[model samples]
Target chain A: MIENRPFLKFIEHLVLILGVLVVAFPLWMTFVAATHDAARMGQVPLPVLPGPHFFRNLDVVLNEGLWGGDGSGVGYMLVNSMIMALLIAFGKIVISLTSAFAIVYFRFPFRMGFFWLIFITLMLPVEVRILPTYEVVAKLGMLDNYWGLTVPLIASATATFMFRQVFLTIPDELLEAARIDGAGPFRFFKDILVPMSRTNIAALFVILFIYGWNQYLWPLLVTTDQSMYTIVMQIGRMLEGAEEAPQWHLIMMTALLSVIPPVLVVLFMQKLFVQGLTETEK
Target chain B: MASVTLDNIQKTYPNGFKAIHGVDVEVKDGEFLVLVGPSGCGKSTLLRMVAGLETVTDGSLKIGEREVNNVEPSKRDIAMVFQNYALYPHMSVYANMAYGLKIMGLGKAEIDERVKNAASILELTEEQLERKPRELSGGQRQRVAMGRAIVRKPSVFLFDEPLSNLDAKLRVQMRVEIKRLQESLGITSIYVTHDQVEAMTLGHRLMVLNGGNVEQLGTPLELYEKPASLFVAQFIGSPAMNIVDTKMHENGNEVTIAQNVSLALGGGRLKDRAGQALKLGVRPEHLVISEEGANTLPLIVTLVEHLGADTLIHGHFGDDKTDLTVRCSGTQSVKVGEKLPITASLDHIHLFDPATEKRIEF
Candidate 1:
């Protein structure tokens, strides 16, 4: 039994390593492809070594236009993605904070029943409502605009649920202390609730950023003009226009670039995210 | 300083549980009052109602001739130190103390001045003031809570079991500190606690509550020497009062316990209500190991507790099913299974009806 245990453990480690590579293969391949030119890309078994074209291909993305210089460039799409992700994160955070605070702390009418309704929205998948959501946005003539991109998902159930639990975990004594300090509801939220919940906000910011950044289906369905397309949509168009045999190098690079910033953000705020969930003991 | 008056105060929980039944209480200007009770009593709910945190449900609560029932907590001019010491964890001790003053639009200089003065009064160093609450010990957080309340300089101070969260030794120390602070400021303060010793030592007047009702309200000595009901008699003393069973006799002292333990209470006004069941209560301290006294009962010793200044003897009467407690002065040599003749002075004996558990009229 003892002799076979080490071999069994070796098999377990191999499985774990294989599992990690499987999940991260595309991301790893993107970075690998970013360094290689179109010639090195088709080599059998792939080029595992780094090439010098890292910044060269980056400049291609930075300088050259996508779809044969049809519109602005990938830079425009990158900027648009940044704007959409940040606005969605910021806007969703504010709405969640105010709504969650009111729902959790205040004695408003039907507060629990209303929260149950908000919870139900979480179960309604975005795909189920896409048709009606598109029609509403179209009727409002908000297509191909930043609001069209950001506003539909701004009223979020996930952010609200996260914040509601966070706010509920704050001791009521803190609120009473603030009140005794001459603070009103507005001041109490700004001064006490917001600052006390910074960890949760940081965690939720990463979650919302990833949610908005990886949004390809909605952005593709909503906008036709490439001028206002998000980074994901730009990547999609870049792959689609490759004529029979796609540019695996550029497609993989674009996809890898899409995942990097959010990965960095999640890694940076990972401790805060776990802390937010574990702060129930407080 | 402010005087607080509650006329016909009532609090009925939404679940139809009446927490504070119609209670009328008055706190003299600059007087410290303590509302004390066991858990599930309405002491905290009462304090919150006074602070405008809880909706009163019913009553007229006036602070300094101002009807404060409808007033916001801030406009009510009162500061509260919570049991958890609720100092802002995110802010430094300085910010926690100064946040109120800043909101009041006090000048930055004045805010700094008040916060510093309060910090010094609390013995919080300048370096401590700049540090966040998480860095402070439990006692330090409690002091910071007081500092925050102090900086406001409100007319009244409400403490909701403020020292209950501290360790045993720290609670006693902080309790004394709070009393001294209140004396120096002479603020009309209402303190709520389940600790009877805290109420006895700190309050100028004490209100004992039970089951959402003010059982008795009087000065500490008054409640100690003369509780208005059976509950207060048992609630006031450290070891509960031993209420031996008795039967009332006509016109004179005709009450007697088991084992022919009988005494003619010199002047029981309840002489008119005779031949009915009655209660004779005496505190453990008053139930001494007597050499000779009018009302005497023999007891069987069960346990002995030596508390330095005194020895507490757990015993029971001859034929009664209930146990008895006798508190003798200083540490004395007493053992289990030893019998002692215990008696209570007439003046110290408390009388109540067994059925209603209400004290007989004097």
Candidate 2:
């Protein structure tokens, strides 16, 4: 704005357009594939323009679910995924917040030791501990249940550390003020600490919801029952090698369906998400 | 509403560093006691111990006749306004003020009434009350913070340098408001500040502290005119009191300054301490340029600061390297390097035992 350089501005616009095309091209192709009939999808030189069978494909996917698989509908899978995502997001936030509060505010015998223990878990992600976690869930008889799917992934070190950092930035005087105001520990946490970190919570919720919704590995390992299969994992079942080749149209439709809720979450909470992501301290 | 007493209160951290060393003071019912000191002087540590934010390491604290050494801060019935104005940033002004009442489980109507009353007393508008803390100006936010404490109606009010965050003009404005508000409410209050002016203007009695020990406790004028020790004398005033070493004469009636300058003690004030080394103290305003006096010292002016109303001349005495400052009328015209004889009235002069750092009698 200060220079008013036309050539530099033109180059900026060109680079932005290229970035947009790079991201949008895959999404455009998925929509095009979802719009065509199964026969049209398999033909040479797939349709660049969206076909007229978009509504039929959506309806078939929603009601019939994935073809050549279990009879459970895509609608039910969508509901299952929604529950898992919400539980994971809410559970992670609650646990992380309380743990972070304890770590930051109170002094206990093993406080730093416990903090470092949680920090070390960040190095061993779910992928590394997947088998043992699955065995424990199965031994606890939680396999094929919502608890098995969400709870193992709920105790997040990343979320806990972020909340710890957020809590540390809060002024110590606020705690003192609350104490003098006749509010004990829990009341201070609820009335002051939680409300103060509102934007960060919402932002974390957006990210966690997307993370939970798109979860494939853990859900695949535990959900042997097709009734509890998430939409993301169910799409994988539809792509198994079969006699009539893969159903490209229906699988693409399910992929599109799985992406919607998380997209809506990020879209609606975009402002808070950006605010929480950018501002570490007030 | 209630009195606070700290009996030999000591605060030693878990790592074995003592912040407050056996401070004992009594704040009468509805009296404003200001704790003033330099940073790390344990004024804040003492205030926090009174607020129950820090544990009393080895003493007793009582509020309203109840020993609260081991009591929770909330149960002790005190409210604190922090230096940063620790208002809940996300809450509206009304919510911030009502939060404590709500936590105490007050009914909706009662909470609303108290919040409204406090808001009105603080001169905050309805619109301002509805806005969040970040939306208000610094002074308005400070008022909201005070209103938060006011609505609680606690027995004691604790302020931790609340106005230190404001600009000079706003700080002065809030200082008067705080003093007036405290007077109108008559709550037993304890305030902490490193600013001497704030401490002098706000407190009914001032507690001057140094290095975790109580240096002196008295009215502002008492501490001003008769500081208990050398530390209190230098800490209480602007430009600090000028202290120079003076050797007592063998005759017991005269004190020699820089080997040649001598002043008479006027009698019996130094009967037992004739030959001991003492410190001579005089305020800048007390020393005036004079033609002839027995106590007069010839001063070579090195720097002059003119303030239109008064002039501060910074200089040293004849043949000595020790620096001294003199506050004189602005109308008096004098140049640097000019040797002028300056003298202080005998009554305004102070004597301190340099070894003990205690003020000498008379």
Candidate 3:
């Protein structure tokens, strides 16, 4: 920057443009294919530009199930995904907040042991404990239910750590002052701790919602009922019996629909999301 | 509007380290008692124990008449101004002041009235009351902290080094403001600071602590004139009291000055400690420039500090290599390396037993 090297600046811009193209190319291809009909999609080197059948394809996917599958429309799948994402996001925030507060404020017996136990769950992804977790869900008769789809995945380690770090940075004097002000633990948590950590909560909500909406394998294990399938899981089911040419246009349309909610959420709350992501203090 | 009585209170941490050895202090109604000491000397710990912030490991503490050793901090009827001025960062100034009253379940009108009154008393404008703590300056933040305590109207006020975080000029200004506020409210307050000047100016009674033990407890003038030990003698005064090793002469009539020059001890002072070693303490103001004569020390001035109103001459005592300082009027012309004869009156000298370090009263 000090030398004002035009060639170096040009090289920097060139690299950045290349990086954007690499990431944006797949999304572009998906949009182009979603605009075509099944016939255009089947042709070799399928039409690179937009086609007129985008809305038709979206209408078919949202109203009628694709690939001759006996299932509810993608609209119903979208509703299921919304419920799962909301429950998981809000559930993780509440659970992590109370647990972090307990761990940080109280000096109970085996406090650290319990904390480490929760921290160890970060290593056990849903993929690793798939069979046993499914068996537990089956025994509880929670299959084909919202609880089975979201609750098992809501015990978050990263959210707990973030809340713990935020709580630890609060001055000890705040607690003492609140205590002197006649606020017991529950009142202090409701009034002081929760309000102070509002940004962190919003930020974690964005991340957790995306994480929940994109979940593929776990929902596949729990929901054998077609009506209970989420949009992401239904997209996978469209690929079965594809020895003939697959329905590329409808698949692309479903993928685009599944991605719209989270993208809109992040874009609308982009400021709070970035602040919550990068900032711990006001 | 109540008395605070600490009867042999003690604090021992969970690790078995005793932070406050048995401290006994009594704050009468409307009295301002200051606990003054160096860092880690347990001044803050003692104040915390009284505020119910720290547990009393051994003895009972009473506010008014009830034993509050086991009471929660909220039930103790006390308000504290922390050193960092811990205002609720998210709340406005009025809300910060009204939060305690709201928690006490005070009505809306009553809370509003008290908050407005406290804000006016603290000179916070209506526009300023709606701003958060972060929007205020350091001095304004300090006043908000006080306003929070004032709105509570608790029986006792606890201050834990509240002025330590301010700059020097602001500290002086706020010191006056705090004194004025305390006088008007007439609350029983226990203030803690490591600054002797603050303790001297603000306290009706001073309790000096050293290493978790009470060194002396008295009025500022009383402690300045008649210290109980060597530590008190040195700690309370600026530039410190000059203490030197000296020997008592035979017949208990005189003491040696600078190992050889003998100054006669008048009126039979220390008559019982004959021919024994003792420590001598003399405030710099008591030492005068004397003409060359008997019972005088001829000193070569080493450093001269002119403070506009007074001058301090630092030098050794008569070439014996023992350091001594003398205070004189600022108009006096004194140069370094110049010999000046200095002497302290016998009536103003303090003698202490070397073994005990306790002052020997004449």
Which window of ten consecutive residues has the lowest lDDT sum in model 1 chain B?
A: B263-272
**Position B305, candidate 1: lDDT:** 94
* Cα displacement (Å) at residue A195, model 1: 1.0
Tens digit of per-residue lDDT, candidate 1, span A21-82: 99977667678888888788877889776787888777777677544555454777778888
lDDT by residue (B146-195, candidate 1, tens digit) is 99889999999999999888899999999899999999999999999999
Candidate 2 segments exceeding 4 Å error: A65-73, B266-268, B292-295
DockQ of all models, two decimals each: 0.77, 0.74, 0.70
Q: What range of 10 consecutive residues in model 3 chain B has the weakest lDDT sum?
A: B259-268
- Indicate the TM-score of model 1: 0.93
Sorted into a CAPRI-style docking class, model 3 comes out as: medium
lDDT of candidate 3 over B238-270, digit per residue (tens): 878888888888778877877568777645766
Task: Assess every candidate by TM-score.
Answer: 0.93, 0.96, 0.95
DockQ of 3: 0.70
Better of 2 and 3 by DockQ: 2
lDDT of 2 at A80: 94
User: Candidate 1 or 2, higher TM-score?
Assistant: 2
Task: Looking at model 2 chain B, report the run of 10 residues with the lowest lDDT sum.
Answer: B265-274
Model 2 chain A weakest 10-residue run by lDDT: A64-73
